[model samples]
Target: MGQHTILLAEDDPDHQALILRAIEETGIPCRIDVVENGSELIDYLFAPPQSDDREGGGTPELILLDLGMPEMDGFQVLQVLRRVRDDGRSVLAPVVILTASDNADHAREAYRLGANSYVPKPTGFAELTEAVARIVKYWLVTNHGPPADRSDPQYPGVQSI
Candidate 1:
């Protein structure tokens, strides 16, 4: 596989720009597909528009989800993704919660909803850079959940339900 593709689900344009810069700094050369909200993120993940694809690809390697977005929100998106990818047929990408929300409830709910990693979106650019780097390194490089970690119980991935 090439550099792990990161699907960054964020609504704000400025945040998107910052995220792009931070991710690039890691020399990962990620192909991040930014979505404004949860529904769009799901659409992109499941049945993306033809224009979104230069080559045929099924799913991404990682999902950097924003918990707070218009339409559906990250938690709901994760539920749906888990529902759809319940089978071990396809690769269920590791879903990491990346958000500005500092609510402890949100963090608790995120883990309960099957989030593999919960990363608070840092305020400082340097910290943001570090967060992005670590997120990518841990999920894509270090962590190796079962192929069906998100899907199959026996597959030992970051499973919630």
Candidate 2:
């Protein structure tokens, strides 16, 4: 199997380093693309295929989104993703809100905005590593994700009820 790709939208340099370390400790062969904020995340997702290290600018298997970001927050990014999915303009990959906030309202808002999962950022390094490992194992190894072909009805697109 090819290496799994993950897009991490985090602004804090320290947090980014910690998350990257955690992912690496999981021993999962993954291609991680880090974005500084929501705007950068959107650009990275929608940008044309560049002759870069990325795998042909394909959609990531999972998106680790931080709720608090500058120049368009995670919620705004989710809104754009939902619109794109609804318009059949993009493949809506599973989004996991990985934020420092344990606020119930934030979690609720994230879900209402179509986030597939909400994970509060763990306090300690060890705890963070464990959480990240479990997340990687579950989402990449165990989960049966929706079909990649957007035209397929089984493709899990965000739907507002």
Candidate 3:
């Protein structure tokens, strides 16, 4: 009902523009943070909260990850995200692999590494728009996300339905 946040990890500038436009076409009120590579994404997600930084609100509701990135790649990012912290909790937000690669092996590996969904990047603007709309509506509107309090003893990380 309110504005949600999405973190997009995409290295290609062209792809970033396209994805941003597609998400805008959805007409959903959301804050999207774009990181050029997996390492930047990791920094954005793990950096200590700054009280004055409104853009860096907090953990995103969903993460749109591109498998091909400089420095750490999407799979490595997922590994770090899914790793259990000392407190026995992992990142609770769902990660969706939105990549240009249509290889089945990539999809399989992404799932194995804790990706919630693997979507091959649409070639056309219209298709990309539709796909982004559906993804945003489903994850930000229809889906019931994990609890926010990671420190809670009963809190379980994102789970598959």
Candidate 4:
């Protein structure tokens, strides 16, 4: 129906490229905006002064978050995201934990902190493509998320979606 925007929070440059390629292969008609660390990710979402000009607009429809990061980390981001959601801010996007971590404890905590899905990063390109395809299909095509408020003049981000 409309264009979708995905916010990806990843630290590694190589992993970032790979994930971007995988998502592109899915052909979901989405705009993928990236942030390198937890701090940048939070700033991007919350529009903290420096990140006020977020390229993808306001909040993304989906968030692909990496668990391990230099500052704030995925858990911390999740904590803030959940808090914003609870506060009824415009950040109702679903967060999907995309990580290399195979630790069950990490997954459990991610879920506990409000991650909608936990997808372990696949090592191979083919596996990564398949995983991204499935994720796109499920989240973009099958799932229903918050309705965009196109009427708001201040929120130009969701207008693209």
Mind giving the per-residue lDDT tens digits that candidate 3 earns over 1-161? 47788999999998889889888888888889898888888777665444445343566788899999999999999888878433354546788899999999999989987789989988888898888888888988899777554342222233222
Residue-level error in angstroms, candidate 1, position 141: 1.3
Model 1, 1-161: lDDT tens per residue?
Answer: 46566788998888889888888888876788787899887666555355734343445678889988999999899788676667533446788898998789999989887788798999898898898889887887788744532243232222344
Q: What global local distance difference test value does model 4 have?
A: 0.80
lDDT string for model 4 (1-161, tens) is 47788889999999889888888887778888999899988766555344446553655778899999997799999898787767665546778999999889999999999999999988888898788778877988899977756565345322333
Q: Is candidate 3 or candidate 4 better by TM-score?
A: 4
Stretches off by above 4 angstroms in model 1 are 48-55, 85-91, 145-161
Candidate 2 lDDT tens digits, 89-160: 655668999999999999998999889999999999899889988888889888877555533322223322
Cα error, residue 22 of model 2, in Å, equals 0.7
Evaluate all candidate structures by whole-model CA lDDT and list the values in order.
0.76, 0.82, 0.79, 0.80
Model 4 spans > 4 angstroms off: 48-53, 151-161
TM-score of each: 0.81, 0.86, 0.85, 0.86
| Number of clashes recorded per candidate | 1, 0, 0, 0
lDDT of 2 at 132: 83
Which parts of model 2 have CA positions greater than 4 angstroms off?
49-55, 149-161
Clashing pairs in 3: none
